[model samples]
Target: MAVEVKYVVVRNGEEKMTFATKKEADAYDKMLDLADSLGEWLQQAPLNLDDEQREGLSFFLAEHKDALGQILRGAAPAEAPKKAAKVKMEKSVATSKEGSTSEKQAA
Candidate 1:
């Protein structure tokens, strides 16, 4: 059987997380799947801030666009960068706070 490894590339560098058979890697892109799912969840059931929501939506779009580009060029879904993660985390936290504030204000 041919052994395969999964590597996530970032601007600064790259990291290898899992080693699987070539078959397994083709069957499912573990890292991208989680990232896409989380990104979708954040977009669908967003917390509050319209701007943050918009930003998240934009991020989602950019991700998909990049994925499409990769597909066209015969590549796998790319790993999200650290900067994108940091921005998303900050937006999520801000959204949660805004959601709570709105709830308290309403009550």
Candidate 2:
């Protein structure tokens, strides 16, 4: 006989998820909390939203909290870092040149 430990997240008297570790359960619970708060806030928006739409928008924002946080903090969306962009561009040029030479050889 073996005993297993599990963490379960329950919401409104229903079990939402089960996790092997408490950390994962806590993270999921936190996201749900954020979604709940966002849903309430959306109710105050001028645009009319049906209940389903508000719920969906709330979850979407909660799932992308990192990007939303940056925007809310007055930061513009970040572009790819210059060094990485340069490396990607170099790789693309090298590949295109290699393809042209290969085509010439085949011709």
Compared with the true structure, what per-residue lDDT tens digits does model 1 show for residues 30-59?
444555555666666646647566566655
The whole-model lDDT of each prediction reads 0.60, 0.91
Error of 2 at 107 (Å): 64
Per-candidate TM-score against the hidden true structure:
0.27, 0.66
Over 4 Å off in model 2, which ranges?
Answer: 74-107
What's the residue-level lDDT of 48 in candidate 1? Answer: 63
Q: Measured by TM-score, how close is model 2 to the native structure? A: 0.66
lDDT of 1 at 90: 100
